[model samples]
Every structure is written in structure tokens, then in C-alpha cells.
Target: MNHISLYAQSLVYIVAGLNHFLNPRTYLAIMPPYIPAHQFMVTISGIAEIILGIGLLFRATQSVSAWGLIFLLIAIFPANVYMATSAKFIKFPAWLRWLRLPLQAVLIWWAYRYT
Candidate 1:
């Protein structure tokens, strides 16, 4: 169970990191309207995610990486809330609509356990 959970967390971040490079424009599209220098901010976020994802792979860095991700998730949570509220623009299924909010909390909890 521990391995599965850690692997899942690692996979999520790794995929997110890849998406940062592959579909960077899509990531940029999700930035909140209130943020300035949107493209630059998106790019910076991508870099951070990628670095954290890589760091998570090492046993030595596992705890710190998990903690880092928790903070990162918290920092970007507003975007998730914004997307959830703007369903017209987002258009997710009802089940998945509010799912991420709680999922973030769970992920944070699980990540913290590594430390």
C-alpha cells in the first residue's frame, strides 16, 4: 500500500511535469485571469512541478518532495476552485467537478506521512 501510494503520487507529478512541456499552452490557458504575466508564470510553474516530480523519485528527497508538493497544491488551489465554479468554461462531469478539492487534501495528507 505504501509503495502503491508513493508510486501513484510520483506518477501524478511526473505526468504533470511532462504535460508542462508537451501541452504547455494548455497549462497556460488555465491560469487565473487575475495573474499578471500569465505565460511566464505558467512556464515557471511548469519548471517547479518538473523539478519537484524528479526530486520525489529519490528516497532521500521523498519527504521534502512530498511537503513541497503539499505547499504547491495549496498555492494553486484557487485555480481548482475557480475551475470548479466556472463549470461552463471547464465542463467537467458532476462527479469530477468538486472531486479535486477533497483529493488535494487527501494527497497532502498522504504526502505528509512520508515525513
Candidate 2:
């Protein structure tokens, strides 16, 4: 289960990394309005994600990847909070809607443990 989770998480991050290229405008749109130099931010984030995904591919780098992911998640959290508050961007089932924020914490913990 530990390996399974790590692999799954790694795959998700890889896909998300690719997303920066596949949908560059959408990725940029997510940046908070106060942010400047949106293009640079998106490109840097994409590169980081891809690098982190590759790092997670090896056991020797797994712990470092885990810590990197934890910080990555923390860094993007304000976007999650923004999305949660802006119903225009998020629509969760009644049961799951309330769980999103808390689940981010759980996911961070889970990655920390299994990574």
C-alpha cells in the first residue's frame, strides 16, 4: 500500500506537471491576482513538478521528493482555499465538499508517512 500510494501520487504529479504545457493558459489563470510574472511562475512550477516526479522514481530520492511535495502542496494551498470559497470553480458532492480542505492535510501526512 505504501508503494502503491507513492506511485499513484507520483503519477498524479507527473500528469499535473504535463498539464502546465498542455494547458498553459489554464495553469496561469490559477495564480492569485496579486502575483506578477505569471508566465515565469507557471513554467517554473511545471519544471519543478516534472523534476520532483522524476526524483520520486528512485528510492534514494524518495524522501527528498516527499519533503518537496509537502512544501509544494503548502505553497499552493492558498489557491485551494480560494477555489473552495469560489463556488464558480469547485462543485463537490454534498458529502465531499466539506472534506476538501481537511483532506489536503491528510494527504500531506499520508505522503510524509509513505514517501
Candidate 3:
């Protein structure tokens, strides 16, 4: 993989991971109701993001991390869908909510590139 791509991906994940803690409520709000233990799941996913982000920085772990991120993206996709469908629950504009759907695909592709 290109150094720039790897660096960019690492940065995105790290920042996002940090945001999970810095703004846990934002994440908690978007979570679907069917998923139980919202707080616990949010924190666990945040920790996973941090560890995966750090792992991406190392050559030995890059592939594993990339795969992990792809899995993470897939795993959390329902939240994206929930955000798009349940627009009233989110504070963002309708356009932004709809955009998240495609953005999830982009993120998945981005992580797949690393693998």
C-alpha cells in the first residue's frame, strides 16, 4: 500500500476512535434500538478503533488491521442505515443523513484497499 494512503487511513481511524470517547453521546444517539447495551457497545467499539488504528501503523499488522477495519465498517453499517432512515433522531440535515449511506461504502472500500 502507498504510504500516504496508509497514513491517511490511520489518521482517520485514530481521530474517529478518539471522537468516540470525546463525544460518546453522538455515537450513542445514532445507535439502533435493537442493539442492546448501547453504552457498552460504543465503548467497546471505540477501544477497538483505537487498537486497530495503532495496529495499522505497523507494517506487520497493516493487513490484519485493514481486515479488522473492514469488518468493523461492516459491523457498524446498520448504525449508518439507522441514521439515514431515522432522520428525526439525528440533528443533522436530511442531506447529510442520506450521504452517510454512501460514505459507509466508501469507508469499506478504503479499508479494503489496505488489504
Task: Give per-model TM-scores.
Answer: 0.83, 0.79, 0.93
Candidate 3 local lDDT, residue 88: 57
The global C-alpha lDDT for each of the candidates, from Candidate 1 onward, is 0.76, 0.76, 0.88
List of clashing residue pairs for candidate 1: none
TM-score of 1: 0.83
Alpha carbon lDDT at 103, candidate 1: 84
Error (Å) of candidate 1 at residue 3 is 2.5
User: Against the correct fold, how does model 3 do in TM-score?
Assistant: 0.93
lDDT of 2 by residue, 1-115 (tens): 7678777888878898899999998767567777678798888888778888777878899889878878887877765665566565555564454566787798688668746
In model 1, the number of clashes is 0
lDDT of 2: 0.76
Tens-place lDDT per residue, model 1, 89-109, is 555685685897898898788
Candidate 2: 10-residue stretch with minimal lDDT:
89-98
C-alpha displacement of 67 in model 3, angstroms? 0.5
- Candidate 1: residue 89 Cα off by (Å): 1.9
RMSD of 2: 2.7
**Candidate 3: deviation at residue 15, Å?**
1.0
